[model samples]
Target: MIRKLFLIASLLAPLPAGAEPLANKLFAAEKSPSTQESMPIGTYAKGCAAGNVELPETGPTWQAMRLSRNRNFGQPTLVQFLEDLSVTATKIGWKGLYIGDMGQPRGGPMNSGHASHQIGLDADIWMLKPASLTLSRKEREKISSVAVRSADQRSVTKYYSPQHAALLKAAASDPRVDRIFVAAAVKIAMCKTAKASDTKWLQKIRPIYGHDTHFHVRLKCPAGASLCQTQKPSVSDLSKGGNGCDETLAYWVSDAYLNPPKPKPSKKPAKPRPPVKSARTYVLADLPSQCAAVLSSR
Candidate 1:
């Protein structure tokens, strides 16, 4: 019958509406935070933040860069930590700090760059100690952070200064900070000058790729934040009680690491499987279930 054929065709046709939109797109559309109580749900790279507060575009000692991204929002604790760190910058003889991306208005996967900022606890503090905090929004967009690591990634550049080390020391030493990510060379440079007996804080400064321009700061889950997940502690048995200054650290800066040999061609075609999704391709269902409630909230 005609009705049967129509039903069969309907069943065969693709239903775009049934396929949910990506979490990044949904979250990116949100220009404000949820009304729910503050909470960082799930892991850093695969979660959503509720009840985030915006850091003022311009502060007395800091200016949030890339204002047009509208990513100056974070949890209350994160905002406070940045404010305090800006003051710390002044004490270290720097003018102040040039803060970078904190999180989206309602923390979730962003349209581009950074996976860990999905939660409200991570922020990027620029290496360039602010030339001036009074810069206009347009200037903030064009002004670039200084690269402290060399192009070869083996050493720190001339731009690296004593005050820069002081800032890192202060930030890593903070109790509120869970960890800080910087270029391996920067960590190596810091390792060279650190007191032999006082390298405990250095343990928190992790070596990672492409953080020469700015350091990424991740804060601890605040007290009684039941929904928050704490990142696993660093496992570096590289030195005396693992301060990460041993030969193991050198591997990251070696030529082998910078230019590894290309893999040999496979004899057989690789089996296709679901690729690991990153922030760029995350969907609503890929995030925590409570995120639905958060997104739906007024």
Candidate 2:
């Protein structure tokens, strides 16, 4: 029957593909190169260029994993940042540098899987654990460093080793780092340290909460690349207890100005009833006795 044939065809139909891959569609929106001379380099410009530098492939523990070579700053830059950080730590006599997550293209949007990890400019470095420190069962339980199954998830903790602190300092000191996330207390500590070190880049470092378990370093996007989605610092909501540290920070809840005012509770008027029509009247003598009796009873 036609119904059977239709059912078979429906079952055989191919499934629709998901959204277009980012690697293929990126840079399609960029305008053609201009003939004008390049702009002069500034402090932020230096930071952007340093952030875009290509990194090596080998890591201390993990191998470099790239999504696409054609994609700008995909895996190479991330690996380079790691290698540079490791090298910096070694120069300072610190050891045990391990990268947590990098270069995850299939992860979900921001706030999900390592979204920062998607663009290849972001990385999560694990907290350093020294071999000399003896940890009781309870103390070990307090330290957070779990094995992540996917390349997108990151662990959160409240503790940081001195070595970890050094690595964070090095990254924040680098001109390539646009922003770094650590603990609130650690940020305050870094501010004091930065003031003592006479390094202006450390003065530029901003601290946030809940990143004590790992370090999240984000780099500025490179020239002519649309894959990077670096956000400029905005005004913070000081009213909500968030330190509005950045300039031009706007109150996120400013939409209260546009919201409709609450309606006042008022008493409702009673509904009117329909007017009833009087029954047709007839002279008592002209009406039939039964009908007249019924009407009289009504």
Candidate 3:
């Protein structure tokens, strides 16, 4: 009994020294859903989930990787969307999606590798779909996702196939999906090949950086989420213009992008880099006021 008591106390202890408050230590300490009321607190980059559900590690058409990160938790809507998308992938001649991070158990900033997803409305779905869906947890951790970016890093490589466009089309078909971030090359490829009937779905596929291995999906804020904040109109609007493959894409392929300017050599010694604050570091006051109540609830 004393040993068990010691373990509990240790788990509740404050974070080690010099850690950034942006990746709030409290988020790592939370292991259970805070409430049954499904609501998001703020924007995807600055938010928390009041109630979250865990996506099972493996499903009929998909498998969640990096289980050790414990980021398989998300709002119920997000979880359902992923499961449904997995079925869509299977229908389009691919095995199924290999899922990446969703959000932390409490749905806040992470220690690393993402700027959004703090609100549980965002998910990263790997382009690599395992031929089989029965991979063990060990395999899930060891299997590396292949990068579909071309050697030049401006376009999709040979590994990217027509099936990828089909997959993205399926994901964007859902009205709930607000935006899907992919590389410039992928967007261009879709613009060139998408049929007339399918061009509208292309509007939701925005070109972004470093999504060679996975595409991020963000959902529209669910109905009746009063405290939930919506992103600016530009982000949510997909009908502003044609598929973004005109002069805008040229920027990604320009020398400025292909060969970025290096920093001028500093005369003085460089100052020490400051600590990075992740979503996990956000304190209750740093987030929506209601998040405090969410964190403290069951």
Candidate 4:
């Protein structure tokens, strides 16, 4: 009976492990107000945040989903950006925006969900606009957003619309946003639809994996945040302020998309792979040195 109860409880929890470390648990469970001085430390994929703020669950034109995850947290700038972007989206014929995960309360590697939202600058906005801005807590928890891509992962489905492109453009146009990640099909659609004058914002819209259901927004390292690490821009990144439609979009639709080459077979039998470690198993040493201080602080 005890074993069955344990199994039932585990299924209800989102974390991969039954128990986490002291420091990991502390940072994960914090729900206090953000510190006055916002500081981001390290790159998006591997970093931590200080003075994180929580986005209100319900806003005038937006509602945050997945409240159980406790991930609706980020720097002050990120929270403000979402609120402002949602209002912008409403003005352009979009119903409203449904926000997904932002970052942890303190912003670090989470036990699950994402590898990049470790910094407070990253946020995920569901592609499916809510029917109403005021979603109840129960509805937010039960509702699931539909993916924009088809099963083959090659193109956008019927769920996509011109308003989707407008919504993305509005977010990209913000000076605070560094880049946005969407599925290849979404990027292709935007390239074909956006006006030439709006192509500059489209350049910041990058193609990444598993973004058909929602788009990922990354903010620039805020000024005065000296400790924050910025990602090195690729040489082809809007080179001389040119549009990205020619080469990058073409690659997603080429033969590489339909038939990828099989890996070369090894002559010797494959060795047994080692067991993977879950995020909960990670110790203080696995994280950046500065993260310890961030976790220990109020």
lDDT accuracy of residue 268 in candidate 4: 98
lDDT of 1 by residue, 1-298 (tens): 6765664444344547747567899889989998888998888999989999999998888889999998999999999999999999999888789999999988999988888898899999999977787899888889899899999999999889999999999999999998999999999999999998789889899999979899999999999888899988865753647887878789999878899989999999989998887888877777888887777667
At residue 216, candidate 1 shows an lDDT of 96
For all candidates, what are the clash counts? 0, 2, 9, 0
In the range 32-122, model 4's lDDT, one tens digit per residue, is: 5344468887778767888888899988888989998899989889999999998888887876789999999888777777777877999
Count: clashes, candidate 1:
0
RMSD of each: 6.4, 25.6, 4.6, 7.3
Please give the ranking of all candidate structures by TM-score, highest first, separated by commas.
Answer: 1, 3, 4, 2
| Cα lDDT of model 2 by residue, 1-298, tens digit | 6765664444334435543222212112211211222111112211111122233333443222222321123334455667777767666555445444543222111222332343346666655543323334344334445321112222223444455556676787787676776544455444444444254454334554345556667766546444334566642433443442332121111233225478787699668888642111112222222211211111
Error of 4 at 163 (Å): 0.7
lDDT of 2 at 257: 27
Off by over 4 Å in 3: 1-23, 235-240, 262-281
- Tens digit of lDDT per residue, candidate 3, span 233-254? 4433345546666777778877
Q: Which ten residues in a row have the lowest lDDT in candidate 4?
A: 7-16
* Model 3 weakest 10-residue run by lDDT: 232-241
Note the residue pairs that clash in candidate 4. Answer: none
TM-score of 1: 0.91
Candidate 2 to native Cα RMSD, angstroms: 25.6
Give the Cα-based TM-score of candidate 3 against the true structure: 0.85
